[model samples]
Target: MGSVQHLPYSVSNHCPLLVNKESNRSSLRDQRFYFEAWWTLDDSFEGTLTDIWESSSAPLVEKLKIVQIGLKKWARDLKFNKGDKKRRLTKELEILLMDDMDEETLKIHLNIEIDKDEVYWEQRARTNWL
Candidate 1:
């Protein structure tokens, strides 16, 4: 502790840098299931909901738990399935673009893929929709 030098930065500065980095990274992901209003467009989704709502003989609370479990499973499954489909379509687009093809047909497929991408995003951004 003999010499005192004028330093450009302090330990405090680096501390906040480390703190900010840790604070910005979340360890837990959101796991709650949210019902997609858009799923009603699927003919089978309504029927499945009705079945889950009616098939349980348990009282109100228990019935609700069952339906919640069913829907959670359904939504989780849909998430995985749709995620895979989207990835597949994205890869397909990449591959298609790399090769030569008829412009008219490629445009049609591109439009379809774009629509799928939109729907995929719509499902994920439910909170922002409200």
Candidate 2:
């Protein structure tokens, strides 16, 4: 079953309408392969990529497909939370600065900021190039 609702439109002449479906249809999208910039920062990333490449025994085209599948799996297993870590580190660094600034804490905070920027620039480069 579906229901239609009329929404008041602001700045527009026509009224907005929304249709809500009650069916349990899947809403997931078919995500394409995209490399994460932060993956390069991980110590094991190089070895893992090398292993994936060497383990594949297919032609060039097939090998590319295998690598894509392997990368998707690897990304799923990574479980990295960059945004959460950045926010938490920022808060911790602020507290540390209020008391007594430490070299290690400052370094860790800077590293996180660098990682965030790397991801941003990587995406920006891809957008510009494409």
Candidate number with greatest lDDT: 2
Q: Compare the candidates by TM-score and give the number of the best one.
A: 2
Q: Looking at model 2, which ten-residue stretch has the lowest summed lDDT?
A: 23-32
Estimate the Cα RMSD of every predicted model relative to the unseen true structure.
Answer: 12.6, 11.4
Instruction: List, residue by residue over 1-130, the lDDT tens digit for candidate 1.
Output: 1223344556565432212324322333344445666455444678889999999899999998888888877766765676565567566767777785545654654565456557657777765666
Candidate 2 Cα lDDT to native: 0.73
Off by over 4 Å in 1: 1-33, 83-130
- C-alpha local distance difference test of each model: 0.63, 0.73
- Report how far off residue 57 is in candidate 2 (Å): 1.4
In Å, residue 108's CA in model 1 sits off its true spot by: 12
Quote the lDDT for 19 in model 1: 24
For candidate 2, the TM-score is 0.48
Provide the clash count, candidate 2. Answer: 0
